[model samples]
Target chain A: MAKILDGKEVAAALKDELVAEVDRLRKQGITPGLCLVMAGSRPDSQSYINSAVKRCSSIGIDCRVKKLPEDVTQGDFLKIIDDLNTDPKINGIMVMRPLPQYISENTIKYKISPEKDVDCLNPINVSKVISGDDDGFAPCTPAAVIEILDYYGIKVEGKRTVVIGRSMVVGRPLAMMLLARNATVTICHTRTRNLAEETKKGEILIAAAGKAKMVTKDMVSNGAVVIDVGINFDESGKMCGDVDFDSVCPIASSITPVPGGVGAVTSTVLAKHVIEALKLQKGIY
Target chain B: MAKILDGKEVAAALKDELVAEVDRLRKQGITPGLCLVMAGSRPDSQSYINSAVKRCSSIGIDCRVKKLPEDVTQGDFLKIIDDLNTDPKINGIMVMRPLPQYISENTIKYKISPEKDVDCLNPINVSKVISGDDDGFAPCTPAAVIEILDYYGIKVEGKRTVVIGRSMVVGRPLAMMLLARNATVTICHTRTRNLAEETKKGEILIAAAGKAKMVTKDMVSNGAVVIDVGINFDESGKMCGDVDFDSVCPIASSITPVPGGVGAVTSTVLAKHVIEALKLQKGIY
Candidate 1:
């Protein structure tokens, strides 16, 4: 059976470090602050924000949520961003995804201050990630993957790593991160021909395709390290990942469970970004 | 024998299109203008700039070179960029790389306005390339590779493409471009183990490792399309590509030659960006 790479363990360890960092800053009369901006009352967004707020509070960081009306005009939405951009109290800012249809995503992405962009929505931060700038903030989800790998002592250098997705949020960014670590990285997507053939070649396989149980045991090689980034509900309503865990676990060397895997660590990564953003704002680094 | 993918042919075809575009803009009382900024007189940089100027002139676009001293201060260098940023006459700006030791390349990269960054040095442009934004400018070398593929009707979709090298200017950007087109892209570098094993799987192979004739017959699969992005002088001072042309040519289906391949098309791609920059400035698009 594959050894379980526990996300909770990794997140707890990270939280401990962040807690100390926050305490140090607080003693210096500085409290790291994060602001969550949401245009509409999306249940998903609300749930995510709630958890993020709780996470920040636990780490001794100040967290705020700005719940705007569903009918907020683009100009009004941008005005809020502008206010937060200059607000000394706010160290990091995260605007919830899938904003109201009327608001321009592009405008908001550009308007957010790069120094305060904890979620890395700003193109400047995104550019920094691509250019392998260590100082720039990476999106929370992708950063969580790297954190997990580091915690588990998985050496990425010279490894044949396969990422099965091409999203800006996860797959592509993760590939860039892995490449920076000297891994031979291959990116596969829905359009990939002979998917099984490609997946089997990876010493480290990452599935972020968002399809539950899409990766069967046949797709994975024995003793390969499998990282499932997918969060989906199987037909019976059980939370699952892209990999068919039951079958693949017996053959794989390691794997992360869906609920306790990447999902569990994402909010903590957000909290970590808040602290980094604070340091950037105060020139502490 | 593999068909020779002639770079001059592709460049000539692109030049024809650019010539017509420039003529149309000129008739509208607007001449597209590009400014080339160089810090010192590096012979290599001078040669590149000279060819670019000649190409721009041939395409009926105004090209100006700003030559600075070897010991130019960062403040003075940035002042020049600041002036060009607001200059109404210049629509596109390219700062020659390998600036003086006193100037920070990062500072210069960030200083150039995204609207005028024809060479895509600005991180904003790099971010756009990563995000698959079609509106943003791509680096000339990578864009030229895509242009050559398009000109030859070599479909990238669903192809297994391998890129050797991860430089921001070439491999990484080209991988992103290919991924955007639905191709599965694997990035291999110096740290990659079993390099030949990984490369042989690619139906489309790109060599950008800057090593002369590193790719041998055993490294490529039969009938694969090979593109050499290297511009190196072998021991005999003969210009060559990353591929061992004599050995691999018989088995490969198609290949791009060094002197007449990617090198021949890079300058033309720069000229295309000038037109694009002009259109963006005038809001013509």
Candidate 2:
């Protein structure tokens, strides 16, 4: 049986480290504050916002949720963002995505200041991440994945890694991070032919396709380290991962379970980015 | 035998099209000046600079070569770039690489104005290319490859592309561009295991690995389109590409020869970006 790479444990340790960093900021008369901008009452975004608030409390940071009406005009929304951008207390701002259908996402993304853009909604940070710019913050989900690998003492250099997604949040940035660490990363997406053939080559396989048990036993290489970043429900409406957890776990050397894996790890990393964003404001970088 | 993808013909045609665009800019009283920054006496950089100057003249744009001493301080170099960034007449700027060992490349990159960063030595533009930002310029070498594919009517959508390098100038950016066009692009670098196995899967194989004749006949799949971007010298001091052209030519459907391939195409695209940069200055974009 493969060993479980527990993200919850790693996240806790990471938070403990960040807590001290936050404490330092508190003593310096600067509170690391995250302004969560929510536009509509989407349950998906609400769930994430709720988790973010809890993390803020645990880490001794401030969380202020600014709720906007679903029917808010583009001008008003942009004006609100402009206010937050200049707010001395707000160190970082995250606009909860899939805003009101009428509000342009691009306009809102452009409106946020790059220094306060903790989640990488701005185009410049998104591009900077892959270009390997140190100033840019890593997208939280991808940063969480890296944290997991480091926690497990997995060597990334010269390894063959296969990332099974092309998402802005996870796969692409994660691949860039891996490539920066000298791993040969192959990014396979929905259009990739012979998925099994591709996955079989990976020493590190990252399943982030958001499908239920899409990666089966036969697709994995022996002793492969599998990281499941997918969150979905199986046929019985049970929460599951993109990996066929039960079957692939026996074959893989190291594996991360769906609920207790990357999902559990992201918020802490998100909070860490907020703290880093705060430091940026202080000109520490 | 594979058909030769004539980059010289494509580049010539592309320049012809740009001439009209440049004419319009001239009519608007914007000459689209390019400032080519040369530090020290690197023969390789000088050779590239000569071509860039020639292309500027042919396209009716202004070219100025600013030479700096090999031992120039970091402050002086950055000041020069700062001056170029604000120079109203200078539309685009490209700094020849391999400055004095003491000077940091990244510093010079960040100092250049993004509007005049036509070569994309700057990290932000490199990232913007993949981030779906239409405002940023694609690095000339990668843009030239795309232009060649477009000239030949080779569709990128849904094609299986394998790029054999991870350099900022070509492989990484080209993969992003191809992915943006709906192609499933796999980037294989030096650390890739079973290199032949990976390359064989691609419908379009791009050889950018700088090693001379690194991609052999066995590495390519039959009827695949091969793009050789590697510029290297063979045992006899003759210029050669990564692909073993003679052996792979029969197996591939179409191929680009070395020296005359990407090299012939890059300068013209570089000139086009200057015109585009000028347009941005005029608020035409």
Candidate 3:
């Protein structure tokens, strides 16, 4: 069996660092705070809220959840987002996505203040990431992936990395991030021919296909480090990753598990972003 | 002899379409307008300006030249950009780069309105590009290259595209644009090992290395389409491109000449952007 990349342990370490940072800021009369705006109470949104709130509590940072009914007007949603954006104590703002089909995500996204855009979903933040401007934050998940690799002493510089998806949330931005680190990155999607051949060439493989077990044992090379960003459901209704974990784990040099891997690091990265936002708000940066 | 891509011919066709569009917009009481902001009297800058003015005149759009001294302040440049942004006649704003070293580029970039950001150099516009939201203009040269290929009905879907260099103006954004078109894109920089090996895999090779005669005969696949974005000077003083034209042109299926290829189509795209920007201003789109 290969060495299991324990994401839960890594996340805990990150959270500890964030907690220490928060404490230091508290001494400086600054409280790192995050505001989550949930337009409708979907079960998945509620679950995420619970986990995020719990993490905030453990880190001793202020976490506020604003729940709007399903029938909330676009005007009302904007009002809540605007309030969080101006709230001097609120350092980060996250709007739980997949809002009512009628509501426009683009409208909400452009309205978020770039300084408080902790998720880095706003166009201004995304642009800053692309330009290497460093004025804004990268999305929590992609940022966590880079931080995880760096924390473990993995060198991305000049490595051949293959990202198996092209999503705004993960794959596309991850490729840009890897390229910024001097990696020779290849981004393959559904249109790509012979996906396995491409995956086998990766010194590092990042699977974010959103489909359960899309990457199998034959796709990865021996001694490759795999980062699984997909959270999916199996036939038995069990939460899983896009990687065929049981089959590929034995062949891989290192791998992150589904629930414990990227998912765990996300909330902590949000907390870190809050601290960073507070620093910016105070003009410390 | 292989059929050269004939970018000049392709660009002429596109200009014809643009002329019709400009006429239609003019009939609707919106004359397309472009404001060229040149910071200095550099010979290269003046040459580009003269050609752009000529294109705008031929396309039935109002072209205005805003020339400033090399020692102009960031504030003065921004004030001019703001004035143009507010002007009813000026629909697109392009600030030529390589401003005085004392002036901060970022300061001027942020001042240009996203709606009139025809150059797409500003962070706001860059962010829009990253999000795949065409809210603002794309930089002229890259957009021109894409339009040239699209005009020829060349297929980008599933093709292996190798882009040399990573300049934000060309290589980086162009790579993203190609990926958006479903091409399996690889971006190689100075740090990449075996540059020729990477170049050989490209079904479509984009050379933007800013180094004259970098892509030699041995580095290309037979019958590949080549788009050279470089405008570097050869050893004897004449302008050349990243591709070693003499050696590779005979073997390649299609190629763009440095002076008349991508550069020739650039201003026409800027004119197109002006029309688009007017539409945005009028809420037509």
Candidate 4:
């Protein structure tokens, strides 16, 4: 059986480091703060925010959620973001996505201050990510994957890393990050031909396609490090990742489980970004 | 022997399209204008500028070169850019890169207005490129590669495309563009292991590593479509691409030559971008 790349363990270690950093900032009378701006009461968004708030509290970071009405006008939504951008107390601002249909997503993304764009929604941050500049914040989920790799001491340099998605949030940014670390990165998606052949070539395979149990044993190479970034529900409504963990577990060198994997470490990564955001805002580093 | 992907043919075709478009805009008394900002008179920069000016004139574009002293201060350089940004007569602005060591390249890249960033130097344009949005212009060199492929009716969708290099101007953005068109894109660089192993898998191979004759016949697969984006002078001072053309040409189904391939189409791409910048600024389709 392959070794389980435990995300809970990685998150715990990261939280320990962040706790010390947060304590140092608190002693300096500077509390790292994060604000979650939501337009509506999306159940999924609410659950995500609740977990994020819980994680932030544990790390002693100030986390606040500003819930607006679903009918909030685009101007009002942007005004709220503008206010958050200038708020000294808020070092990081995360706008819950799939915002109202009427609201201009681009306007809100552009309105947020790049320094406080903890989720990296700003084009400036996105550009920095693409350019491999350390000044910008990468989205937490992808950063969490890196965190997991770092904690496990997996070398990315010169490795053939294949990412099975091209999302702005995960696959695309993650490919840039892996490439920045000197990995030869390939990005595959629904349009990719011979998906199995592509996945088999990866020494480090990342499944971010959001399809439950899409990756099977035949698709993965023997001894490949599989990082599953999918949060999908199987037919029985069981939370699962993109990889068919049971079949591939024995063939893989290491693999992360769905509930206990990337999803577990993501909130902690968000907390880490809040601290980084605070440092950037104050010019601490 | 492989069929040559003629760059002059692509350029001529593109020039015809742009000339018609430029004439239409000129009929409206709006001549698209471009400003080439250079800090010093580097011979290479001068040569590039001369060719750009000639191309712009051919396309009815008003191209101007702003030459500053070698020791131009950052403040003075920025001031010139600021002036050009608001100059209604100038629709596009391109700052010749490798600015004097004292001036911050980042600052200059950020200074150009996004609508007028014909070379896609601005982070906003880079972000748009990554996000697959059509609003921002891609750098002319990579854009030229696309123009050649489109002219030849080469299909990118579902193709296994490998890009050798991770340069901001060419390889990286080109991979994103290929990915945007639904190609399974892999980016390999100097740090990539088993380089031949990687290149052999590419149905479409793009060489932008800037090395003189690095890609050889053994590195390519039979019938692969090769796009050479390198412009290097060999030991004999003969202009050559990254590919060993004599060796790989026989093995490949189609290939682009360095001098008559990507380079020939680049200036035309710049002229096209100037027209695009004007249309964007004037809110014309």
Ten residues in sequence with the least summed lDDT for candidate 4 chain A: A100-109
CAPRI verdict (incorrect, acceptable, medium, high) for model 1: high
Q: Predict model 2's lDDT versus the native.
A: 0.88
Off by over 4 Å in 1: none
Provide candidate 1's TM-score on chain A: 0.98
What digit string (tens of lDDT, one per residue) describes model 4 on residues A1-285? 889999999999999999999999999999999999998889888989999999999999899999999999998898888888889999999999889888988888889999999998999999999999998999999999999999999999999999999999999999999999999999999999999999999999999998999999999999999999999999999999999999999999999999999999999999999999999889897
Error of 4 at A125 (Å): 0.3
Better of 1 and 3 by lDDT: 1
TM-score of each: 0.99, 0.89, 0.97, 0.99
Candidate 4: the clashing residue pairs are: none
Q: For residue B125, what is the lDDT in candidate 4?
A: 99
lDDT of 2 by residue, B1-285 (tens): 999998899999999999998898788777889999988999889999998899878999899999999998899899999999999889999998868876898778777888899988776686678765778899998999999999999997767789999888788888888887777777888887778988998899999999999999999999999999988999999998999999999999999998789889999999989988988877895
Winning model by lDDT = 4
lDDT per residue, candidate 1, B1-285, as tens digits? 999999999999999999999999989999999999988889989999999999988999899999999999999999999999999999999998878899999999999999999988998899889889988899999999999999999999999999999999899999999999999999999999999999999899999999999999999999999999999999999999999999999989999998899989999999999999999999987
**Each candidate's clash count:** 0, 0, 0, 0
Model 1 per-residue lDDT at B241: 94
For model 1, report DockQ. Answer: 0.91
Question: Model 1 chain A: which ten-residue window has the lowest total lDDT?
Answer: A127-136
Error of 4 at B103 (Å): 1.1
lDDT of each: 0.94, 0.88, 0.85, 0.95
lDDT per residue, candidate 3, B1-285, as tens digits? 445666678778878988998888878877878888898788888888898899888999898999999888877877898899899888888887777765788788878888888889778788666656667677888898898789778888888888998888998888888888888888888888778988888889999989999999999999898999999999899998899999998988888888788887887887788878888988885
| Per-residue accuracy of model 4 over B44-81 as CA lDDT, tens digit each | 78888999999988999998899999999999999999
